[model samples]
Target chain A: MQYAERILDAIDMETFILARDEGEAKGFMGRFLADLGFTDHDIVFLEQVGPGVRVRARAYIHRPGGSYGWLAEGDDNGG
Target chain B: MVAEKKKILLVPLDPVHDMGLKLIRKALDDKGHSTVLLPPGMEPYEVVERILDEVEIDFVLVSRTLGYRVGELLARFVDLVEVSGLRDRVTLVVGGMAVRPELAAEMGFDAGFGPGTTPGEVVAFIEDRPFAYGGRAEASEGGKRDLTHGFSYVYRKKEIQKRLAAIAGDIMGWAANKTSPGVERARLRFQALNKGEKYREEFLEEYLDYCDELVVLSYKRKQLPDQTRFLAQDELHFLKQYQNWEGRSKAARSGIRKPDVFIQYGTGCPLMDIMHIKVCEAWGADGLVHFDPSGGARTEGLLEGYLAHGEDGTLLTWENLRLIKNFLAPNTLWQVRAHRGLNTPETVVLAGELGADLTKINMAYASLGAGMDPARITIDGVEAIRWAAHYDLPFDVVTNEELSGVPAHKAFAGMLIIAHLALQLGGRPILQPLFCRSPEVMIYGQMRDNYIDYNAAKILALQQIIDAPLWPGAPIGFLTHTEDRVQSSLTTALHASLARSLGVEAISIASSDEAYAGGPIAAASRVDTLRATHEAFRFFGRAGIQPTPRAREWSKELIAGISKVLKDVANSGSFVQSLYRGLLGGPEDGAYPGRVGRDTLLRKEKGKDV
Candidate 1:
């Protein structure tokens, strides 16, 4: 699927989070964020990959305003 | 009675609009009239009692900006005034956003004021001052004074004369600005004939009623002496048909009911051109003007002939005038363009005396120089009215809110003023909606020329102010490709029907090809399809219920939002630039085809490789 479509599909209006687990999704999201010109953010792993696997998955993109929303895995939220 | 400042009271409905009311109050005050404005929310009973008890008023001005309940509310107020026995004692003049003079007259108000009413008008009406140049006295009986006749024929004639004379000077000023010397000369000669007493005897055989002023020259007479010629057909069949059309129009005007449609075919070859007149006909229209604008291109010859001496390189000549005079229905509301910078006071003076009704001009065009010029326009029309005082030749001033080179709101404000100015100058003012057409959408495209349409709601909001004859030109033939499916015909019928419900006087449905090329016969044929489709809707299942209320409300909101944007931009003194920036700032790929620049399309159409 196209990236935009995938990003749309991954949106969770209820939970306000990207992927099911935050651990493994973090590494993938980190590289995507770097590609999207995000150099000054402190990334955090909020969830785990495959439940038991202790993967540092990415859950959010931090903004300068200190008001950050959840970002989907491997998707760059750039203006 | 030119005494001290007259005290005026303005009472607005609490829950309704106060914008128009506030403005009128200011106008009255600025013009040396003392004014009191009662904001909406007070009980009508209490409000009246309070005003009666408090203020020593010259005139009580009630403003109602609320909709639907206007008539009932007005009746209540009238009843209140009558029961209080103050109707005759006080010059009870009511002005409001939604009030129409005609409707207000029926409601029993001594005078009704709509939007765009100037500061001086209220004063003049209240002072009971006759117009400086014209007589305010009721027409005096001379040759024909018999009330025994069934209808007020003589009175009606006198009324028409009085009305026409009031606006004649404005018409002359308008004509002088545009008409060629040749046409001007002809017009003058024609007026001279009417000035002579022989015209009454000459027109006796034609059974002339409203058209007593036109000096008709028979077609058979070679080199007819009069300046205005009514050319008859050489062929007897055509002549008979011409006579029939005149008779039919006369009957329609006589208040006798006739068949709904009376279509006339033009003399030009059928495939390329066709001219027709639709009288007092309803296209499911509401609030639209009952006036006509088809004269711009249709009667260009007459306009050109008047502007340029013989012809302005346009085929319009004395012959064309003769043909139209003999064939076209009598008292056809002919149009004249005032903003074209070509019409002058002299032309209107001549045209009025020669008996032309309804001169449509753009007031915005005249006021483009950053200052207002009312006296110039008024005096010109007034002069014509003087010469044609007996004919009752009315000068119809048509105005718009958006012109070619003005801010939208300013243009709208100007439109309101134009109508009021017309009435002030003693002429009838007709308001035609300045509709925006989308040239990017092929379904609604027409040669990249833009007519602005703000949210449809803006027009409705305006209806909240001035209730003059409103003509809403709606999109008709934008849906062409549907083979009986959701096609242009169906969509147009729905929109036109909606427009009617909105109270438009005339609703026009454009053709599919109008966006690309000048609307030719093919386009008109498509329009015919729309008319047929509309006819079917009346017969079909969902016949006459009000259309998409949600859409209408949404449109109003959108217009309000646009107005906010405009207000913000206007504050910076670059509204046009702001509009362009907003429209052009969108994603390049997302841009509609019409807004992408006409040159780009012209290149693309020619298959030129960029």
Candidate 2:
């Protein structure tokens, strides 16, 4: 069992970035996720409020038809 | 009751915030504990001096709102208490905004309470008893509901009812003399299940005659279709293992009534479907709809076995359905759709035999939108409804032709005809109108102002026509969702709330992946909408979304249009001919009569009963 295996499907990270518009918010989200070592990430939502942009980004930890790490036996780290 | 009265000291360290301490003191007093309250703006030394001067203090409760240097101040207070040798004599507790239990422990306090801590919890802590917060026990008592309960299924509009009766009578009359391959398979399948081995073999031999070549080959050669495989022993073992795993229980509904929520699950594999079903069930879904492969409907016969397919829809089979059914919660309502394709009747029979609570059937959508011959679907759909009635399963007449560019009026006409036919046969049929941004709405700009008016009109018009249980379904918010989880979930929740406001019986909701086509819907996405719907329900407790006056206007137009379509259908002489002529939905409306099972009707031999 691995730590990532505990994630049922995907991890969504939402935050408010002090960006000027939707494009800048998306750029900041990409950099933020990339800084956190997330390569396969997508911007799920982005809306510009008066002060900043609220963004939701998702990274798929596991998908159907793939080998689910949680299903594996004898993995002590799996929760 | 406490063994003895315990003296407690409540200290408000903040200059302006003493609400938390005051509430705790009141609860302590109610619990029959002797308590002393220290005034606000007391220095750390003054609190220590008060505790020292108090006679045999049992607990010292301190409250502070988080601010600049608040942590250091709390630390200094704890250090002063320790230095005064009073830390070991009393149970020191700290709580306020931004104060966590971990931080309290780090600051040398025995316990901490953060924001939203209730007085009951603090009292329980003082009395050293476990506190049950929230309504978990009460939430577990929300049992399964029969959405159709208490509805009389009466028609309010006598003219529309009369027209529907005429159309239904014509349909039943035409179908009485007709039988398609789908109908024959259903009959033989039922007989085969009830009789002995010899009879089953004989029935199957005759059954192969009506099957497609691919089906016949699969039966004879024991080979499955492409991208499909029978479930292995290990997979079955895994299923049993998953079912037996601990902590699986019914989800709490958080007290929302009207519009019981259902999730549609068809992940190509029964194992995956069962997993998804469990996830949805544990996340407050009241029911589930099984989606079979589209190709399975077009094929002449159904495959048999515990099979897994690596595709879009699960293969409809007795073993597969039973396998999935075994894992469902006792109260979870299950619906296996038999609406379209070649296996409508047989699917209904199988679903009934497997103990499904509900089934779906619609002649118009099956023929027009789902690519089944109109004549064939009419015969098969009639038989399916009968089987559904026989099994005491409530079937829903879904108007999915609205998805194929047909206007709501034409689709409603088709749905009402089937619903009336079901009523005629003594069957309980739920009316399922698509709560979507349908092609009709898109083209006509009916939803340009808002999504409420047209959808509200659909319900209003249906209520004017009949009083059957209305379940807006087949995944509401269809064609209005995107790959964005938040947007998709918000749209689904909004639709669900609207359905709730309209007092609909039930609603079928999509996951956050409703618009995502890249892969199977992720399990987490299912929870997204469930949580959102729960929030929406909470936000509008007994309140409602107000649709504009246009809703009433559109409702009148829809009713008139439905009446016109029914008149046309009734005057077409034969209901089957009316379908062929597109009176209910024409090719111009993007509803083409399907070609599969075309000319496959078997005429009854002379002097032989059908």
Candidate 3:
């Protein structure tokens, strides 16, 4: 099983990024997730605080009705 | 076998916050190891000098509360130790509020323990044994609680009890000669499953005769409904793997005594439901309520097989239920709801046979809110109660009609009637009042002041009349949540804490996806509310949320309203007729008599089958 597939559901990444506004925070989150090689992701929560934005990003490893990689047999991704 | 005691040195690197080291020192002493404790605010070089000056030390445990310059300080300490030639002589470990094992390893320390590390872990490290975090031993501490455990099922108000008895007697008489296809199927299912294979074929033939054509075709020809299919073998295999992988670990609780928590799971697919169930179980949910499809309720008969649906509620089938039941933790209470459906009796039968701990049955809700015919549901509901009692399954009489815009008083009246009927039939029934922002509340502005007073009023009113178990649900915080996960989870947590403060037996809470109608509830959403509720419980441990004096006044009014409703039903002479006549809850009150099983009851002749 791949290491990423081992995540039972979605992976939620919460962080505070130095951004001017909500839009900038979303952009930073999108770029950050893309940089991390996350293709399937969404912004679950976002808030603009004083100097930065508090953000919660979600990348779904497996969704219902989709064939789960963890269930499939293959070489271990060693996540 | 006792291991050889070794010299251990405990050093508190932090000027303050030396409690962690002190705890470890006590544990090391208990393990019969000689330990030297260094006072706080000692310089890193002084610690190294003490370690070098001392005799052979087995392990050096240093505790540091992480701060801005603490990392640099620790690195310098490690450099000093390396220069002093004691680096390889002893195992070096660091632990504190912010120290992670990875950080320690990066800084050339042997090991690190962060917050929540127990003393036993340090002892295990000293003994050279592998330490597992959150051991399964603590998981076994929680056991299934009986929600109906100390309630006497006695009516405190004599007037309500007298009126309810009269109505219950009328219901018993009215249902004496009445039987529906639901009741007959339940009987045949019991006989077919228990008697033998010969009886099974004969009973199935008779069973299909009473079912609708759709159910008959699905059973006889092995054809499934649209958007449904039998679960693949690999799906079941993966599910078993997931269950075993999670293992038996109990979710951590917040330390309050009353109100066991429950979460509802019905993600259409049994596989998905099991996944959600496992998450809820691991996050301290005390019980689970199974929500089957709304279509399944309106349909005449249930489909068979390990089927998965592509919609909201899980399909209610014996195989499907058995699969879910097999994977639940031993201590997790499972409730298969038979409250609002054409197959109420058979649902209860399946739940009972499959080892379900509780079931839900409400004739008034089924008839008025869920669209089942008044007479049909009464007969089936009565039979369901009988089977529930026979199987020793305690059911909850849920008053969700309030969500349909019925006032709390009318809904409670209906709930108490079904509860009294269940009691009359020797069944234990828990009263479930919804802790929600119902439409009635919106219309009447009952909660315009605060949420606490009105909810507390409902509980007080019920307590004034009866002494049964009160479980505020289907899901509390109904209509109060939004699409925001934070808001939804917080609302659910607040309602849960309020329910606990009211000292109810149990509460069914919603996922953080309660108000998010865009898609199916994600597995992570279930953990959000559970975590929030855990925090809420921790925040308000034994400190009550006080409802104002208006609660008592509302309670008195609610009791009077319920009394008036019960009296009307008693005077009507038949419970079914009262339901049809809208004595309990009428069209104006937002409850309309359902017509799904209209005129479906058959009168039984003396010693003859219908």
TM-score of chain B of 2: 0.83
| Descending-lDDT candidate ranking | 3, 2, 1
lDDT tens digits by residue: candidate 1, A1-79: 2343333222211111223333334445566556755454333323211111112223233434453333443346552
Instruction: For candidate 3, list the clashing residue pairs, or say none.
Output: A3-A79
Candidate lDDT (C-alpha), each: 0.38, 0.83, 0.85
* Cα lDDT of model 1 by residue, B1-610, tens digit: 5546788777775476667667767776766778788877666676668556755766778777636776787778878877776666566667766454545677887777764354555666756663221100111112211111121112222322332233333344433333222223334445544567565354333312111122122222322222323233343233343244211111111111111111222322211111223211111111111111222222211222211111111123333333333433332333322332222333344344434443444433333321213332232223333333333433333322222333334344434434444554444544455443322222323313321123244446455444455544323333232434235455545544444445444444443333433222232333333344345434432333343354356445533443444344334343223223332111221221111111111111332322
Q: Pick the candidate with the highest TM-score.
A: 3
In terms of docking quality, model 1 is incorrect
Report per-prediction Cα RMSD to one decimal: 27.9, 10.6, 9.9
Who is ahead in lDDT, 1 or 2?
Answer: 2
Model 3: CA > 4 A from native? A1-79, B1-10, B19-37, B41-45, B48-61, B65-94, B98-139, B196-199, B246-252, B606-610
lDDT of 3 by residue, B1-610 (tens): 7877989999998887688888899998999999999999999999999998899998999999877888999989999999999999999999987676657887789988776578988898899875533312333454577889989987789999999999999989988998888998898888877886778679878889778888898988988889989889987886676565343233334445458789999999998888777767766787899999999998888888899989899999988999999988777889999989999999999999999999999999888789888988999999999999999999999888888878888888999999999899999999999999999999999899889999999999998888899999979989999989899999999999999889999999999899988878976677779879877887888899999999999999999999999999898888888888888888898789899888778876642443
Backbone collision count in every prediction?
75, 2, 1
Q: Which 10-residue window of candidate 2 chain B scores lowest in summed lDDT?
A: B245-254
Give the range where candidate 3 chain B is weakest over 10 consecutive residues by summed lDDT.
B131-140
- DockQ in order: 0.01, 0.03, 0.03
* Top-lDDT structure, candidate number: 3
Model 2 TM-score is 0.77
State which candidate, 1 or 3, has the greater TM-score: 3
Q: Give me the runs in candidate 1 sitting further than 4 Å from their true place.
A: A1-79, B1-190, B193-319, B329-341, B344-357, B365-408, B438-455, B474-492, B508-513, B516-530, B533-610
